[model samples]
Target: MTQARRNGVLSDATFDDVRRDAWPVVLLPFGATEPHNTHLPYGTDTILGSEVAARVAAHCMAAGTNVMALPAVPFGVNTTQLDLPFTINVMPSTQLALLRDVIRSLEPHGVRALVLLNAHGGNELRALVRELQPSTPIMLAIVNWWQAADHATFEQAGDHAGELETAAIMHVAPHLVAPDRHTWGDGRSNPSTLEGVRRGVAWMPRRWTQATVDTGVGDPRAATAENGAAFVAQAVERITAFCCELAVADPSSLWAPAP
Candidate 1:
């Protein structure tokens, strides 16, 4: 096998090899272009999503799984955060349309499965998957990388630009992170006025400005590159295992028969 085939990156693979190899499964790393506080770059989610997907794809190939990683989608539903400067929000309908096209394009190439590896909190894609799965021939699955891990190492995993993300960026692309700790936001978030919402029963979108003072939801002062590496390693391992299984799964009968 060639290096690109072994790596299992669609962009890096040559057309000849892609036609010859016919990878059955593809991983689409979906992320958002949004702010991650003052310390982290706007592409934090996309960077992490793409990085994690690439790593997982490489590992899957090593494990003899026919898998490929597509280039990351660097935008997502950011309706609440649109007020924040430079935050791009793609309507859910638009996102679905784009996803539908990608799925349709993969059908003729013998791709049987597509895993949507979502990295951003805002891009809730399960509903979209549910809507698309019945209409398409290919199998669809979504994996939220952050939620896959236990995340017990950090004091606060944070909803937006918090300890987990700060550490992750520090690990993946240290240069993108601001060096001065003094420049980092404390990531303080205000509580919702609704009692049910506070207790997790009711739900409502938070106004970005009103939710947090500095566009952060968790304290990132204590984040370390070491912790981030460990967290990402754990997540990658788990996600890779799942992809390997999915790659080899019989699509017509994915679930086991009952006793």
Candidate 2:
């Protein structure tokens, strides 16, 4: 009935008379299934990823970009949180294989590219993308939201499960946020000093137990639903603009400046 479908903003929701080359951009919300301290839900990654992705889709509609938002890939790199009760982790290889299949499916269509709105911090997915570059003609760009849109605000908040995340949960899914359990630890200071942030220069791995030690990071007391709304909205706006720009770019021109 409409010009936009579910995950791929350019799809036809009716699925009737669907043409092979009718879609636009294919957006993916990749997230993790891990704990966010004691207050946030295990679905935090999915919630944030999907919500942000949806916001981007909406923005694209306003921007006149025929992009669609896809359902989120809930399980991310949670190897550290594997020890936690409900957390699950997907291997990088598995993610790569899955992405390859999905990309292949969209390559023949009008889906010009893919925008990965990522919520997890694990960088393994970056490597996975590189592996898929050859077979997948679709341009893929990964936007680690926290890094892409809100790094400044996050560093100001100190750590996770702190102000930023608490506010985000409160704004997106208040029911999942335990207002009473919202607390902070003083061990990892704001912008955690290089010493507190480093495990090993070359390689480092943190056990899930170590994560709970800090539960959530940042200053939850400082978090407010208002800030979350503002930040999430900004992220969506930026993500949409980024996607639109990529949607029309010359694929071979990535080697040079946009100008």
Candidate 3:
């Protein structure tokens, strides 16, 4: 079994062991099955999400915080990239239903918080969370791992299959990355779309084909394992800190004014 299997991972732990914990925080890694340019694997998002969750869970457990890292949900909202041959897309409504059910299961199990460790850009859950919050008893949070750290940390803040992702996969799963076949992407954007997003005034789903010819948004030629290692370390540290706080937070007063 893998180290991830031994450390309070839900897929690896028995029901008896899981039930013994008073109120563990559950980490659900969410990813998508889509092409990651010519170099990275289709499962890059899933692999990265799962790896981050496992690391955070192991860190929290060793610190005396009960945490369970669930296996990554390999399918996410990939509607934009459906044109890609092997991309698997799940509708936004489908994702919401899946999450609602997942959350329902954890509440009765004494789970305090359900953190969605999201890895794909297309899997936005804030709207679903808003709709579900009033109905559910458990506290839910979403963490876009890439957004947790400062973009200035890397030479380039890539959009997709770029230096940022390439470097991360290199460190997290080096064997799966083929840097030798690196490609270039300028991470282009329609000026109007960029401006609207920056102003928080407009929004629309991007057509992947129109975005880039290679299905990539950033340049990967300069990506290196060292760069990946540093970025992943920073991201893990930030995520682990958030999980630690979630573990001890009281659901009743989670949003109540501090004394």
Best-fitting candidate, scored by lDDT: 1
Every candidate's lDDT: 0.89, 0.70, 0.82
Give me the candidate number with maximum TM-score: 1
Supply every candidate's count of residue pairs whose N, Cα or C atoms clash at under 3 angstroms: 0, 9, 1
**Shift of residue 202 alpha carbon in model 1, Å:** 0.7
lDDT of 2 by residue, 1-259 (tens): 5534453343234455345335467688898777676677888877888878777877776777667777788888766666677778888778888888888877777777887778877635678778887766788888877655565554355445667777788899998877674243432423323564564444455554654465555556666788888778778777778888987888887897577
**Lowest lDDT 10-mer window, candidate 3?**
182-191
lDDT for position 203 in model 3:
75
What lDDT is obtained when candidate 1 is compared to the true structure?
0.89
Q: Looking at candidate 3, what is the lDDT of residue 8?
A: 66
Query: For model 1, where is the 10-residue window of minimal lDDT?
Result: 1-10
Clash count (model 2, backbone only)? 9
**Higher-ranked by TM-score: 1 or 3:** 1
For all predictions, the C-alpha RMSD in Å is: 2.5, 4.1, 2.5
Q: Could you tell me the TM-score of candidate 1?
A: 0.95
Question: Which lDDT tens digits does candidate 3 get at residues 1-259?
Answer: 4444477677788888776777568889999999887788999999999988888887888888888888899999988778889899999899899989998887777787889999999998898889888887778899998887777767776888888888889889989976456244444444334777668788777788776767878877777788778788888888888888988788787766677
